[model samples]
Target: MRDIQHIEIPGHTLSVRVDPGPEREGRPALWPSVGEYPIYDPFLYTTMTTDDERNHRFRAALAHLAPDRRILDIGTGQDLLWAREGVQAGARHAVAIEVIEDAFHKAAANLPALESPDRITLLLGESTRLRFAPRADVCVAEIIGSLAGAEGAAAVLADARTRLLEPGGLVIPHRAVTLAAAVRLSDLLPEQPVAFAEAALPYLRSIFGWHGSPFDVRLRVENPPADALLSEGAPIEVLDFNGDLQTQQRTTTHLAITRSGLVDGVLTWLNLWCLPDEEPLDALSMKTNWATIYLPLFDSPVPVETGDVLELTFAAALSDDRVHPDYQLQAVLRTADGQQRRGSLISPHHGGAFRSHSLYRDLFPAG
Candidate 1:
């Protein structure tokens, strides 16, 4: 049986059903599965709010907004933090949009406490599909994903800028660059060993010609060992939120090997430029909600040495869902002795089939 609870918001009382199974740290799990995804995780929200670097950059960007300008906040989340910050920074009016119902209710509940509640309007819907008067002087969105634009920020911001914002309007996090570098896989492997029972069961199952299928999994690493770095981070893609949000991006960079090491895969991170000509928030060394992502190249580490040059071609294309993008990396390693090795890696492994879905074709026929 599920427990029912009512949450009070600005204009209505939200009824929430609580599942009675697992508990997270003695507190009932408040996150509910909604449609294709679960509601925003509270722990993740907490981590984001606690990220000093991210908050500081956002505040700096908001402070640059013109006084009395209209603001539109997309994916406001639960706290409505950025929208509230805009109002505090002199935005005359604000429109906050949230697609998740649970997050919307939380934002609604916090609306009444804002310094100027009457100046803000909360809308529950997808910003890309919602129409608004083209009068907003600024558009603020924090929909950046693990892969920077992986959350469909490109398409969403492109739609908003063209349809909602006035000419010369500002976009907080005006630009972003996705970066990658070759690294030792040993630097990211978990230290703990699998339990005896768990390890034995998996091995036994595999002995009967029932080996598990191979799949791609991205790992989030807080801090990679310094000695594991094989090459300097190279920019793979640059996104201009204020101008064009490219759905497809490709770049090639040559990285000189810094030291001899075993290369397992590449390390990816984001550098978010909150404002033009301002310092960016670096995900690699900063305390932020985002962690460095590890993209493995092989099941085992590939040996490498100093004085080698790695030519990497990185490409990312938005899927039919317009959210998660498929990524591919092609590598050609040439040694000082003229020997060369070539390999390639693709995320999602599922070829271009997802892009042909009928729903995406109907929604974005131009693609």
Candidate 2:
């Protein structure tokens, strides 16, 4: 056994283990473990969450499933459901596929029945690439976020459906709705806009950092259409985690201020994808892993008055090529007169196998 250690990745914090001494052949090196939290393990909390209250509800809903049913639980956390008092009430056999080794190790202990060689099979790998011959009658996954795109749920589900699920296999919470609204919360900024404005000229000579960036661009929810999932095309479909999307049009919305304050940033609320045949994906109104993707739309803080209106536009498209897929996100803000303010976002792709060797980099920003 090796001692645990901590290691930091560029954009993410992760935990790993390391061998203290002696050289070993064919053994891979380990890094420090990401950190732990009270009541639950943090790493498992992010990837395999089953002990939480929200997951308990998800388990209960799955209880309604009939016995002897073949179900594929993707990203299963410690095989928690198998032990749930209600689980055996419905599912006769459950298959759990996990990607993380730590969670799987813990799961191996937590789910003792796994050793029985009956009623359960735990595969140590990602569901996206699981090569299972069993066709699931129902594919269960809690991989969802408030904004639908948060945990790469679309990608996980799409993969399961194509490779692991039986034809017409039922998807739980068959529907999902993503909602967006405009809000004013300037108190969160590190420094007030006025001071930064005075320092911009001299600061230009210094190291580049995010400053004068739009902290909050107000938004007014203008009729979010009902879509089962985010997609590209005429009506905009469920955003395919595995596919590239092209922005066909760009539009803006101006929101009226009910309260007066400095505009700092924008917040996007995403919903979990739901398959109707199965239980609703944990409801956003209920327990959710909701998060806000902040876009500092403006470099300088803008004073917003009661009844004042600020316009915002979102332009996006998914790039082509499975060898490389780029999700393009561009945002801009302006006044009613069409005068543009200081907010824009051109996102870059990072992580995964292509990060180091991608031709898309040459094609991005489209020349």
Candidate 3:
């Protein structure tokens, strides 16, 4: 097979990506994070269900807290995962909420098969919109996004805190943070234009069509290379679901350039603590279902040396849909020579600019 493969879109022409580095070998399989989009299928759910690291930690937390407590499971999916697990873990009862119609129907079907099905209450609606009678003693959810709060965990859980859960109630996956570091795209792979694996094409088409047009969709790199980071990762956004949870927040963080290299963008990933005392499951280090996302800031890569400091301001707020958060990042690079360069990025979980950036333009060439 040729090193690069030419593909076709209805009104656009896609050319072959040039040779990437020899060590990289193949195109990285790419997928847009569909969680916030409310698109549920076995494709996404299977990953989480099979994620032993995620499951083990959550189960451990539930076993320690769910016994004899009234539990609430948000986004329980087709399998009613946490709700069923909660009942088995000795919870008095579990209320399972799912918004996706098909998944909710399947969850309804899955309910009667579980032992003591009456112990779980099934609700087919958004947790924020539905009313709870007596409130819950614990709440469990797996609504985490690739960017941590990108799925609106801060807002959704904050609502639970006010209405659905008891005061100081336990929230599984206690805290999550979005981590960022400087990375050179070429160094991450080869110098060639990036390519999507064959499996990613259908999902790409679906996503573009889902948005009614193509946009600068977030890129999810599967199994990122270990040596891609040029600076130590720093927390850009923090979501303490159990503590002072804020739906909208703007934070500025610093990353000291540890290695001299061309900085293309910030490579961000997730680090999650399922319980207060648990070790965080790191997306960058652990082989979990969570993938890393590359937020391209510079249309043209910037040159930097060791000792350079990158001051980054990251912002997140509700998008138009009001369920997911839109992300904006502004980065300023300050060098020892008093030279400074700036770059910025806007990645909305929903409707935004179409093929405006260089990367999107390259990926979806005009007719």
lDDT of each: 0.67, 0.41, 0.82
CA lDDT, candidate 2, residue 273: 33
Q: How many backbone clashes does candidate 1 have?
A: 0
Which candidate tops lDDT?
Answer: 3
Candidate 2 per-residue lDDT, tens place, 1-367, comes to 3233332334422222222443343222111111110112443366344335355545554666535677777656555453332246566666777666766777767776543336667778777667876777777765544334334455567667777877766555354444433332234222221111111112211111121221111111111222211111111124432233122224455545445556544545444333234444432233333333333445455655455554555543333322112223333434445454555544322222211211112111111
Task: Return the number of clashes found in candidate 3.
Answer: 1
Q: Arrange candidates by TM-score, descending.
A: 3, 1, 2
Q: lDDT at 65 for candidate 3?
A: 90
Candidate 3: residue 111 Cα off by (Å)? 1.8
lDDT of 1: 0.67
Comparison by TM-score, 2 against 3, better one: 3
Better of 1 and 3 by TM-score: 3
Q: Report each candidate's C-alpha RMSD, comma-separated, in the order given.
A: 11.5, 13.6, 3.0
**Model 3 weakest lDDT span, ten residues long:** 16-25
